[model samples]
Target: MSNTKLVINYHITEKCNYDCQFCFAKWENPNEIHAKRGLSEQLIDQLASYYIGSGLQSTKVRLNFAGGEPLMLGKRFIEIVSYAKQQGFELSLITNGHYLTTQFIEQHSHYFSIIGISYDSQDLNTQRKIGRIDRKNNQLTPTELARRIKLIRHISPNTEIKVNTVVNALNWQENFTPLLDVITPKKWKVLKVLPVKNDLLTISNQQFEHFVMAHQSIAAMSAEDNDSMTQSYLMINPQGLFYQNQIHGSDYLYSPPIIEHGVEHCLSQIEFDLNKFANRYIKTINNSHFLTTNTNIEVNHV
Candidate 1:
């Protein structure tokens, strides 16, 4: 409900290097989840025009590229970001840090205002226990993650690097002191592990809070509990269709994936809580509000 503009969380790809245990995008055929496939240039253009018409006075829109490792698209991702820029939108991206090459870092660093690295633990044993290993030969250790953080800072001094940690049963009790001390990010977001269709690892509120409080001094920490987590974000699945995640029976329930249905129609079916979305962010980023009437419609942009 930011009066400034809209924020679009788009899952751009489905090919991921690391097989994290609790990955939400546990699709049957991940390789099929390419952004270009579902979101055609025509669709993107229509979306751009719709958003522009909707928010005439709004200054900018934030397009957040997420994944199954969004970087799998490589230069294509940069191309899309450039296209979005041409359409008058700011950009941000989330990555697993596996494909953070020096060349790519130097080339597309300025395309994103913020880049988030998904790092759960600093302990190798914990990482292994949680399936954070490369199916191929090379495994990404915590030291390597730290090294990448430093590399990002050294290369792109202006880009804000945020460390996104999911508090789960595997490493919630472990000390995060050493990791935080090594390479601190601009914003440290501690999100409670959300249950998807198949989540084997999870944690309680007490455990998550304990870990967050452990390293508050490391950076400006913002902790989101399950309830807030559900309502806070506008998440689009790999098929270019937005989804609202919540408990159904034993598994999770996701709304249907259809971009042509429009974001507003799908959002209304899910009864998305706009109030939570409006005030969810607690970082230093300047976030303001839109009138509730405008927000009630939410958005029809894909």
Candidate 2:
């Protein structure tokens, strides 16, 4: 268990395509996110050092890039990915797959051990209802979802694919019958829609589990119920502030920015459970097909 690597859910940017109404990083206006976006190479270095230096000595740190959309940062996102890999860290990325291009995949596909794309439901109407539409000029089509999945697998062949389905009222009842049966992912993360303030999209334990069971046979499943989500990850918002989304009071606890408080201080502020962090990687890393050269990455299943 001491050897299990830490997984950091790093939100690289607030600017996202398809503004989900139940967005955890509830920006007041989605349009203003671009103006608010910033992720310096300096902060990126600090983040890498914190996890790499302070984490288990034998294990390589896994930085999972997420966002309003990490791909929205475009080339800069890849720059950060390169920097982290150079520092002896494993990589993962979460995107809606809207910006996956031939050039982008060819250049940056090797950096990530896993590339996750969010897919809430099989029904197009349900997707629209859950705020999975491009709030800007782009239209969200029914076929676009399937197209993006196939394109990603075609372009980036070796890297492990992971699908994130946030179980909510819109998607819970619908059958998830393996949307990507052709391009099977290494893991299917079935996460419950977190209860936030003024939140309407919610799911019960029964509902969340049912969704996971439906898709569990399709791939390795990481089913995080509300209780399972808390302290299971080391999460960094776009501002470089580390936060924990819990199943308790306020639903979240935040730390000072890694720039201001430093990584150790920021981690201490959150009371992060190292045990939980180790446990999370146990289920997902086995079948990752992760092609990193680093020998330090020990997949501890204990």
Q: Highest lDDT among the candidates is held by which one?
A: 2
- The 10 consecutive residues of candidate 2 with the worst lDDT sum are 289-298
Which residue pairs collide in model 1, if any?
Answer: none
Over the stretch 158-264, how does candidate 1's per-residue lDDT look in tens digits? Answer: 88888788889888887776776677777677777877755578876667666755655554466666776665576666665566676353343455544566645
Q: lDDT, candidate 2, residue 135? A: 59
TM-score for candidate 2: 0.82
Shift in Å, residue 38, candidate 1:
8.7
Expressed as tens digits, the lDDT of each residue in 191-251 for candidate 2 is: 7787765467886766665665555455455666665566777787766677886656655
TM-score of each: 0.83, 0.82
